[model samples]
Target: MPRAPNEKAETAKQMYLEGQKMVDIAAALDIPEGTIRSWKNRYKWNATLQKDNRNVAKKCGAPVGNKNAAGGPPGNKKAEKFGFFSKYLPPETKEIFDAVQDADPIDLLWHQIQIQYAAIVRAQRIMYVEDQEDSTKVTSMESAGSEAYMVQMAWDKQASFLQAQSRAMKTLQGLFKQYDELLKSDLATEEQKARIDRLRAEIAKVEAENKERAGGEQPGDDGFLEALNGSAVEDWADED
Candidate 1:
């Protein structure tokens, strides 16, 4: 069932539309600043402000006898884009679209890179294998007088982990490549360019160390540990 809207959220939205800062609104309403900010983003207060501004302008159109008061032709579709979106899109999705409309493409790509990298790093812990003897067992079926069990040997788990990690790494690498390409454009700042270089260097160092520990074996080999002990992922997590 859908939850009912909170009255406090509505009050916060009104306060925000009145040009109040999130922190100030939080103080006024006895709510946490983080909560206020979340509501602002979730409900897209900025988009609401834009609509209100347009309505205000329409209400107070140019004074009489002013040539500048001549607006766009009657059939103008200048405002149709927002209208169409509002009519068809769910509130949450429309809010996200409104929020990202002014975001830089480079910044957006970088955010994806961070997210992908984090996922890859987190998988190491979830899919960790202690040794060849380690295995996973689960009940496959249960019946009135019979039962079935499925057991995955350590090697099988390791192989599956390697396959999944390899796919995840490829996705991360693709994001890195896209970010690097975007960084080459003039719109990129020095800090943004430096971030990719630093990340690439850290990841390369980790891979090299892992290779050494594995006796230089290729990925998915029995000797490889998937760089489970590397601090590169830890550093990335700390940064985030």
Candidate 2:
């Protein structure tokens, strides 16, 4: 006796809801992905389209946050500051992020960079406080000359660190650009590839529009600095 047609369909529907891919569901049920996809289209088996609803995708289809590192600290706050970008990532990519979770190398590196930036901030704050303390002490000193010398040295070091940070950020941005290109070139899903291309074209269009807007007069140093300071990059994640 053969199984009823609806019985098999029920099994497929259950598997699909359990987060099985169309291909895997098909294989498990001795059907093709196309056939499974057809059933999916007709019945809406994989109906959850919202990224927040799905498990993060991994190449190996593993569970999320199963890293080898021992749990110690609760979280990295500086990285938490860039949460806005995570919200905007394509649903599929976020699924991938969810899939890898704490095990993803890129995620770890991004957190490391955040820690580094926090350290830089701390150093800058300490330098400022030290200079203030020195100034207060200088008021009682017989020599006003030594006060200026020490302050100058502190300012020089602060300037150097700020310059290094600016350079490092530029380098990181370049690396992210390359990483996005490589993802499109080597690892991007069909949907991801098409979307990235579209975004690139849009960015080009925006840049051209900006140039036109600044016609006859290029943005001055102040305007450029203002633009930089106001950029949405401040809110975006270090993912790229």
Candidate 3:
């Protein structure tokens, strides 16, 4: 006699199709293994799951019968964890973000600067598209003028963003200069300062000596000495 369609069998079939072994599924679901095995055989669960797996792999362009090394299938947990945002961002922005993601003061400053810069670029693109875009083809001349005004307003916003960005950079420069002065005030001892001054003096002396030597010699002096010494050595060799 055919058992009526029921919840237990349906549950058993679902667990078996999910790649769980019959014994484990039976243990976890508190059902007998023989009953689950019966459900598996009756529902043709293995064949159905195999077909589904092959279909999934084909859709993802993965070779048949090969499990992914990173895990099973594309868009698996690991790949998303590693680079979920990589393809969505512009290459240069992605590169800048990646390079500065964990870096220090420069990263913070770069982040501050790029926020305004990105806003300016977005505003410019909007303005460009608006200017070139035909306004529904049925727009009145006044509407066209209004659209032009809107684009010009967006362009004005972009200019404001750029000027703000420049002011931010200059402010950041001053802040950094103050920071450097603070670090120097706390960290530099008199001895280190004296040594630094002495090193600078020595570098200046060496640079001056090099400059003097470079211009002091006549252009042909080295060649003339070489020729004069060459004949003297030959005469000495002939005497020997």
* Highest-scoring model, TM-score: 1
Winning candidate number (lDDT): 1
Candidate 2 per-residue lDDT, tens place, 1-240, comes to 985567777777776665556655654455777887787788766565434255444235445876635443677532222233333555477556556665634434444544544553454455442442233222334474553322345546545545554554554455445545556445345654454346446545555676678773233211222222224334322223
- Indicate the TM-score of model 3: 0.24
lDDT of each candidate versus the true structure: 0.70, 0.49, 0.50
- Descending-TM-score candidate ranking: 1, 2, 3
Identify the runs in model 2 with alpha carbons over 4 angstroms from their true place: 1-105, 120-124, 127-158, 185-240
lDDT of 3 by residue, 1-240 (tens): 997888878876776676556665665455787988887887888898999989887785757776665465754543232234443555567566667655655335434534643453354344332322323333334663474323335445444444443443344345434434533655445653354345335535544564578775332122212211222223322322
Compute the lDDT for candidate 1.
0.70
Candidate 2 lDDT at 156 equals 60
| Model 3 lDDT at residue 214 | 71
Let me know the TM-score candidate 2 reaches against the reference structure. Answer: 0.25
Name the TM-score of candidate 1: 0.53
